[model samples]
Target: MSSKKGGKSKFLSEDLNELLNESQFLKDSVSNKKITKRQKNDVTEEESLAKLIGQYQANSKKKKLDVNVEACKESRQKILDVMNNQLETRKEKSNNLLKNLSEVMVQLEVDCNAMKDNEKKLEHLTGAVVKCMQQATTAHRQKLKVLKDIHASFKKQCEEMEMDHKTETDKLAEELEDDIKKLQEKLISETKRSGWENLRRTIFHAMQNDF
Candidate 1:
């Protein structure tokens, strides 16, 4: 009975040793799993940081490109404004030149018209002067003709008066000579009758004395 009691005690001791060995193995496995999970979390955090750095670099490059493009646009706009101003100045100058040319042409036309009017007036004045000269010359010729006619008529009247005076003087001298011859013939006849009467009276007286 003492040997059976010793065998039972040994069996109980072996069971307890087996249970302690299994509990130690389980504790080691749980500690290994916890270390692996912590390593995976650390790797995920590093990848997230690298992605954030790459995004910051790309944003910086895009900002620089945008600034250059804006500067180029502003320069191009300034050049275009200068060109427009120059074109406007040229247009104004061309319009002024055209206006001045038109005014000059109008003045030339007026001067030409005035010259034509002056020529017409001069022609009319010349014609009037010529007509007046011709009339004066004709009047002078008529006056000369009238003076010649008056001189000729006066000479003819003087010659006729001289001839009439000579003819009257000759007729009066012939009548006086005829009257003197008639008076001499009557005186001779009266003297002869008186002598004959005296002789008769002397003879009668002588006869009486004889008786």
Candidate 2:
């Protein structure tokens, strides 16, 4: 930003300089034009004055001649005074314009410096913001990692619990199967004893009937 302001100041300076040059050129042109016109007027007036003096001298040899010589001198002096006044006014106006331009240039320079300072401050603020964002991102990543670790641990625990439950269920199933087998063997033995007792009773009753 400072660089950009510097470039802008440079551009403004060039434009101001160009304006100054153009103003100087215009002033010079006006001066030259007025001087040339005054010189032409002076030449014409001198010729008229010479012709009038020749007429007066020729008429004086015959009689008294009345000539407003003082009036002519006064007119010339007034013309000179007016021209000088105009020149001085023009010079003063040009000086004023130059002064105004100089003030504007100085103000622009001051504004450019102020802008450079503000830009530097903005740069610092931007850096701080970027740093804060980076810190927040780092913290977020750390939290995400922690959550992942906790999830992994929880999953591992769940898997271990499921395995233990399966092991206990299998043990219970085996014990139930052993109990069922023992009950079945006891039922078969009771049936054989009852059938044998019935057979012995029948043999004894047949022997008594034959006697």
List RMSD in Å for every model shown: 91.7, 70.2
How far in Å is the alpha carbon of 155 misplaced in model 2? 2.2
Per-residue lDDT of candidate 2, residues 97-178 (tens digit):
5566556555655655565556555555778765665565556556555655655565566567556655755565566456
- Per-residue lDDT over 27-99 for candidate 1, one digit per residue giving the tens place of the 0 to 100 score: 3454476666655654564476446545654565456545655665565556556655655665566557556
lDDT of model 2 at position 87: 51
> Using alpha carbons, what is the TM-score of model 2?
0.33
lDDT of each: 0.48, 0.53
Candidate 2 clash figure, as a count: 0
Task: Output the number of the TM-score-best candidate.
Answer: 1
Report lDDT (Cα) of residue 12, candidate 1: 43
Model 1 clash pairs are none
The segments of candidate 1 whose C-alpha lies over 4 angstroms from its true place after superposition are: 1-39, 125-211
Off by over 4 Å in 2: 1-125, 197-211
Per-prediction TM-score, please?
0.38, 0.33
